[model samples]
Target: MSIATPQNPALAAALILAATTFIAATTLMAKALGTDVLGTPLHPMQISHGRFLFAFMGISTGVLILRPQFIRPHWGYHIGRTSFGWAGVTLMFASVAYIPLADATAITFLNPVFGMLLAIPLLGERVGPWRWGAALIAMIGAMILLRPTPASFQPAALLALTAAAVMGMELIFIKKLAGREAPLQVLWFNNLLGLAIATCAVLPVWQMPTPAQWGALAALGLLMACAQACFINGMARADASFVAPFSYATLVFAALYDFLGFGAVPDAISVLGAVIILAGAAILAWREGRQRPHDRAPAPAAK
Candidate 1:
């Protein structure tokens, strides 16, 4: 078994930040697609279809250019992971349409917490007090930031909450595949299978996009592909629990994108909640760095 140690934290941080930026941009695009901004709002299924389709094209191009040797994938893990991923993304897209983007994004903060907890069983990663404390504190911060009045928890808000749960589960499969194959190969198979799955789901709801929507879809797909690539590479460099908190950075980018694109400003509660989450993450990350048990460079090439 690979010892649990910190990998290249700096490089991992950089990659994860890039992923959050791309992911936040995709969220913005998804919000636009679900609204009348691009003529008619596309269905969440249709939007996800576009994400997989374009991402596949982009990854396939890379596969051709690099011509890297491929490895046999753990198909079971891939299938489970992709299934959860598609569901989570579709739900996330749907939530953005029914609720404020800030609120939708805030709820997703729980995903990493869910991921950390699930990692205990799924990834067989040991969670110390620091990890548990960090996760709990982040969860509390998320709830506080959400400011759940009786009316605050709208029925539609459940969509984002559910998306978080599904995505938390998605992280397990990602961790499982993190270093088992080439990152590019993993992405290629993921997008290829994702495209097939999305196609089947979108058939009933598919409609030709206006030229503008088509452009938006292309941009969204490319951005999401970049996010996935960064995320996978980042995972290769670090353990999942250690990387979980860094994902909160996405909230920052998400908030910025929502405000810039749609003028959804965050209130003091949102700011306060996010600060607490970051604080917990910071504490955990510091502890992880200090321990440094799993510190080894990646193999020159994945076999």
Candidate 2:
């Protein structure tokens, strides 16, 4: 068993904040790429394809410079993880194009709720009353945000929820992969397999991007890579539960982007639901943090 020593809290918080900002920016840029900000809107698949394609290019270049061994025997696990990740990205980008960025991003926070449910079956974990109550509250919050009246039903909101669920599964796969693989190996496979899957999916619907759109696509990939790196750094330096809450800042940044970039704002109900979801998620995070043994295994190294 390995013991964890806390790193500098201020730096961890700053890294997480920066990561969320980058991610929020990437989401807004992706929405613009698939919307009318460009002369012609790209397909969501095409946008996702560019995200992974360029990210792979950048990371692979770094890998060559760093000269890390990339071989791994866990092809099956990599395939499963990247496939879910690609699906989540497609759904998320599609939701972003159609909904307010804040609402879409808030819905994605349901990932922890979904992850808890998945752990029951996949990890053979038992759910106690506290967690079950938290899950119920989160579900209520999701329903509030969804507001699924016949006339008010939004398919985009459902898409965001689906993306969150897929992401939850991706997290589970990541846990499995982390047990046996290096962080860099997992990162490499994620980009490599994600690129291959996205390219094949986008080929039939692909439209050549204009110069401006191309720049946006490149920025999208760069921001995503930077965000991942920042998040990894933050997670490495602090207890995950301590830094994870800062991830909710993505909603704030997304809201700002939505208002300034698109003149869109979330309604009152959406705001209330977002608060409820955050509250429930906070409870879960707190419980997880408290349960973490001081003498437990050390956190894995950042990629």
Candidate 3:
């Protein structure tokens, strides 16, 4: 059964909000644990590898009992997406180490911008006037957030950008695959593929995590898995376009955590950039909601 209804906007919004919160927190938790708890240099590979191993195992167990037939489909998309996901994961985690969570999260939001660019070329998706305008505004915001100077160029930020580009491609592939394969199968494949790749890459650099770090890593893994599952379930309960904007809630959550946990406040310029990104995301979501004409109105929440 296709899992989207235009009538249920509120449900979709809540779903997106919850999912975004979890995802936003993952970066803050990963960076704090990797740097402070692990007592090791923050390497994206280690975090990604560790998180995926635990998440994959956790989800796979459920599949084993509920539906074992997912194994075949899992291998194909999982391996393919893991190739892209690894790059995205590596850059995202690295950015957390190199920059504040809000900054990294803001830059990562550039994924939608990349997706728009890719859609025009690969998917033949039209870049309508409003979307083009939104994209331009988002670019301006990106420049402000980056604030490049001759003396200080952040290669880490660039890696994040590259990762977003790859992630955009992965999104396109996943959307196509979603129609043909079960959601669990798709997720399983991606995780397993990432696990194999990460295991190989992290083996050389892997330092045994201290007990505290182990706990943090475990928490990170659980949060990541739960966040993703919540997102999928919530998206199923409502329309994608309605829920997509709620993804921006991550920015607010990230900013809050940065201040409270790390005492890191975003500069005015970064905040401005974040606002611009949110505006652009809002435009995108509006476009999608309109495109899905039959979307159910969000079910009213209890007073």
Best by lDDT: 2
User: Could you tell which candidate, 1 or 2, scores higher by TM-score?
Assistant: 2
TM-score result, candidate 3: 0.87
Give me candidate 2's TM-score against the actual structure. 0.90
Best candidate (score: TM-score): 2
Compose the digit string of candidate 1's lDDT tens values, residues 1-303. Answer: 222335797888788888888888888999999999888899999999999999899888888999998878889878987888889889989988876676677777666567767766666667777777877787777676556798554666678878877888876776666657777878888888888899999999999899999999999999988898888788678754466566767778888899898888877876787777677656665555555454211111100
Which one wins by TM-score: 1 or 3?
3
User: Where does the lowest 10-residue lDDT sum fall in candidate 1?
Assistant: 294-303
Cα miss at 118, model 2 (Å)?
A: 0.4
Runs in model 2 lying further than 4 Å from the true structure: 1-8, 69-73, 292-303
lDDT of 3 by residue, 1-303 (tens): 332334566775676677777787788777875576457654678888878887788778767878856434635555655677677877788777777788778777767667667766666666667777867877777777777877655666776667667776666555545546655665667677778898899887787887777777777776777776667656656666667776777888988988888889888977897888777767766765665333211211100
The Cα local distance difference test for each model comes to 0.76, 0.79, 0.69
Order the candidate numbers by TM-score, best to worst: 2, 3, 1
Q: What is the C-alpha RMSD of each candidate to the true structure, in Å?
A: 4.6, 3.4, 4.8
Taking all chains together, the TM-score of candidate 1 against the true structure is: 0.85
Give the per-residue lDDT of model 2 (tens digit) for 48-99.
9989987788777777888886554488878987898899888889899988
Question: Whole-model lDDT, candidate 1?
Answer: 0.76
Candidate 2 local Cα displacement, residue 161, angstroms: 0.8
